[model samples]
Target: MSHTIIVGIDGSDNAQCALKWAISHAQKTDSQIRLISAYTVPGVNMSQADIVYPADFDAAVKKTIEDTAEAAAASVTEAGVPVSTTIVPGDASGVMVEHSKTADLAVVGARGRGGFAGRLLGSVALAMPAHSHCPTVVIPSTWPTRVMPDAPLPIDLPVRASGARTAEADGRDRPDFSGEIVAAVDPFETDTPVLRAAAAQAAIYGTPLRLVGVTATHILAPEWMPSEDHLVKMYDEAAKSFDAAVESLRADFPDLEVRYSIFDAPATEVLVSATYTADLAVIGSRGRGGFVSTILGSTSQGVLSHAVCPVRVVRVTRRQPGRRR
Candidate 1:
């Protein structure tokens, strides 16, 4: 089965960044790209002394949206990837979520033109990850500037690392793997779909899988906590669990590098810190035991908001290893 990556394009530079990421991932996974754009028509009530659009107004707006999708698809096609386009009339986030039902993955920018200035994420970016049927990847608009400062803007271009091969020199399109794939590991929930998704992404990128476990000792402390002994015990327990998980993943992915870390800090602080050197940060939409939920809790929100690299939020329960669809 061919996996389809849904990319929400609103003709914004940020959305272009999302499209570039989708195209790159599609090339690596041998998947198809589905570019989508949504638009809404203002309500016109003839009952009031009010305004009404011309008969062709709606048609013209839809045609423009279709043209935009076509142009984006043409770019993806030129990149040698299977590509298609969908232009619908509705709210952008809702439209994308509706299409996500049949998609294997969804990608969007951290912020869009629809949001007000100073907002870290747009409404669509904020809503899709939590609502999408499949795993959703939100790319930061400043990603290119942060991770690939030297690369061209608003396009898919591999960063040239010291020991990495460049497409121009190797005559092959290869993704940059100088960074690691960081996955948030919940000590309470050792085995989760988030881990599986992160492992798959690590395999896809050919990067190291870093399992990060955070224990909020102070935050979870009792009102009359006596000493640091209890906190130390909690940290020790988390470390062991993280180590075991790392070994398990290493055995499962023999060819891939697997490592683990335990941080006695807030979940958001540690996870966001990991993203500094990560190719992608994967987190669960819900948290049961310790780490804050990505959607329901503030930790995931903080990481997604401030992460320098792209973040993938997984909400589904069982995931097939190494399979995006």
Candidate 2:
């Protein structure tokens, strides 16, 4: 089976940006590109309408799909890469998710037709990476370079072996974790899964993991003034949770080095700011709130749109019923 890099295209500017990034990466890795476009038939009832058009709607849609595919393929071909195209009729996110199960990587634009305003995460993009069996990369519109012609795309390999604590030349001790891992934890939510994933990735990368948790609160207080003690206590509470989460992962990764930070600003801002220094940022879909809640909280959505690095959204699939910590 050919390892493929799948991209969701809707002919939008953002989609094109994603397509360019995917094309470049695919070229570097010698991987085939599957440029996919999804279209939906407008709901119409022939009985209600008095006039009927001579041309068939399905045929028009088919032509549009083919045109989009050709355009995408042409771009990749210009870059000297081999690419194929597919057009499907259905939900865009659903189709991409199905294809991602077997693909090496699924790439999507930060903003799309279905994404929310104020940098809130796109429903489809957020959902796909959260549940995807493979690694997913959400490329933001403002990435420093739109197309990488000569830069070699970084590839992450799963962890292979375990080692002891050793100090590097930089005076920092080497971590037991093996993979490149970063964690984005919401302070309001219990961060068990985020911690677990980070530890696992660190083990795989054999690199240290950075754990970042954000707490957004109003700047003002009810009392005469917000005292230093109050601020310290708030941060202390957040720190306690951060430490607890890291501790739980310690048994599995004895040499894992975890760095935790608590930010008292908007969750999205804090997380995105940290992404400037990270390879991958891990975040939970919904926390505290049940499944009925939205896929991303306001902070997460903001970060999704403008993060400096790639984002990995972890969706909660199976949880112990009635279990609360």
Candidate 3:
């Protein structure tokens, strides 16, 4: 089977941004794009036998989506990328999740056609990534607002490198490959799948991979510790260990620049800020704090709720990757 990247489109600005992102990314990866549009008919009364389904209405909806998909396909082809189209009648999240089983990656917008302002995680965006069989990337609505820096990054103990961006002379969409790829490290034993996915993303966009190790009390918070200083010391030790881990793994991908740092802050907050200078931020569905019944952990929710750039949530095993300390 040919490699495929599925993109959920609803004609919203966020969906358009997602389409653009998927197109540019597919072009870089040489993967074919499968654009899908799903819809549901409201106010269907089963008791009314005389009432008929509106064929014209259905036809009109199909026409609109087909046109949108066509336009997207033309744009992708113009960019020298391959594209395909599909239309389904059902819940948008359900359809996307089903297709994700066979897809290389699934892309969606932060919000869809319906939702209130300030809502970062729409029903579709939240549901797809949680239920997807593969990795899912959700493009934030505020992505277009990103511009070249007018100020310096926040100075902190943990090292940071601002992925440079040179604004275009004419004001148009710039491909997202310009910034670095930020990946959250679990410290003890990183999730190989998530790290591999992040590395592949960095390699595809020709960007650097910044490994951020965050140690918080949420998971490793030992109540038995005498004071906060001890916890910080433990967190720092975990962070420094990643230095050797990356050293061994970076050799596997010589083309990618892998750098790592440790910080004593909330994992979600640090990752959300990283999105500002990162083309894409990747995290696992469950962190050290995740529960068995939880579909998404608290850290994933915090970052996905308020990120500027695109965020990806890769599925992890039900249990934590490494043994607890």
Candidate 4:
């Protein structure tokens, strides 16, 4: 059961950035890097008029994928790390998600052709983190360059090593997340599933949870009246619901630490700023303005694109309610 870091590559500038970040991290952790590039075949029914170079399409596509993978491998090798490349044929997001289930950590770029138009299109990156069998890391294109000056990289953090144990072994100070977990809450209605997910992560990390509720007032501002009090009241009610949700989590995880906060700004800004010094930031995929068909909302997209540290976006799925005995 050796752990490997899987990175999704598409040969784009952003994807290249993700590959570089993954390679450096994999080297430091002594983990093998799996560079994957997926290519989709064009539909058979599409008119030849719409197609370009249909004669050599398959071969060209295969060559492109192989070349991209080789280039990625070469980049890592140049940095003195061993890496393996794989070229798979299928839908990009779906194939990446399937691979993510077995990977120790999956890394992907924040924006790409497969991503959303206006938001971080890192669907494959974000999806794996939400439902992966292992922990995942979504690397933004703007990551800071590696700080290694002159040294062979260290091995990966051992499996089953507790944070405290790792810190003690390294003689390095543990990060203080006692201040707040900063859970972003939607004002329209409190999503219980989202809160529960956030609480679980906070407890695992041993950080105090802070519930933050944000309301958008401009949408409902009537030109004649133009009062923001209605929105404030909505936020207040949502805050109360958030508090109640935290209480429920406390009952389940009795020893869990929790708190609450409220904000009147845009959800994205609130969540992004909250992640500045916080150990982890948690937010829901959908909110008041969420589209029924989308897996992520505008706020989530923004946070994933710009957050300073790791950000977890809770994805709500339908399941049978727990039976009370």
Per-residue lDDT tens digits for candidate 3, residues 1-325, read 5579999888788888888898888878779988888876665676875677676887777788778778877887888877888888888888888989889889988887832122558877888767899888988875667643344234234522223232332243221224678888666555356677788788878888877776554455376543667766676567556665566555567778877655555676667667766778888876553211357776777777777788888887665443211
Descending-TM-score candidate ranking: 1, 3, 2, 4
Off by over 4 Å in 4: 1-87, 98-107, 111-137, 144-180, 187-191, 223-235, 289-295, 317-325
Best candidate (score: TM-score):
1
How far off is residue 293 in model 3, in Å? 8.1
Error of 4 at 310 (Å): 3.1
lDDT (0 to 1) per candidate: 0.72, 0.61, 0.70, 0.60
Q: Write the per-residue lDDT of candidate 4 for residues 211-324, one digit (tens) a residue.
A: 666544434557654356755566557667656665667567798877665545555655665554465576655544421124555566677767665555555433322121
Q: Write the per-residue lDDT of candidate 2 for residues 1-325, one digit (tens) a residue.
A: 5569888877666678778877766766677888878777666587998656546887797787788779888998899777888788888777888888777778887777632111345656676765665556687665635232132222111111112222232343322122345676544344466567656656655677776654444445556555678767766777776667666666678898776655555455556555554656776655542111254555556657667666656554444221111
Query: Residue 296 in model 4: shift from native, Å?
Result: 3.4
Superposed by TM-score, candidate 3 places the C-alpha of residue 10 at a distance from the truth, in angstroms, of 0.9
Candidate 4: what lDDT?
A: 0.60
**Stretch of 10 with least lDDT, candidate 4:** 157-166
After superposition on all CA atoms, how large is the RMSD of candidate 1? 8.4
Better of 2 and 3 by TM-score: 3
Compare the candidates by lDDT and give the number of the best one: 1
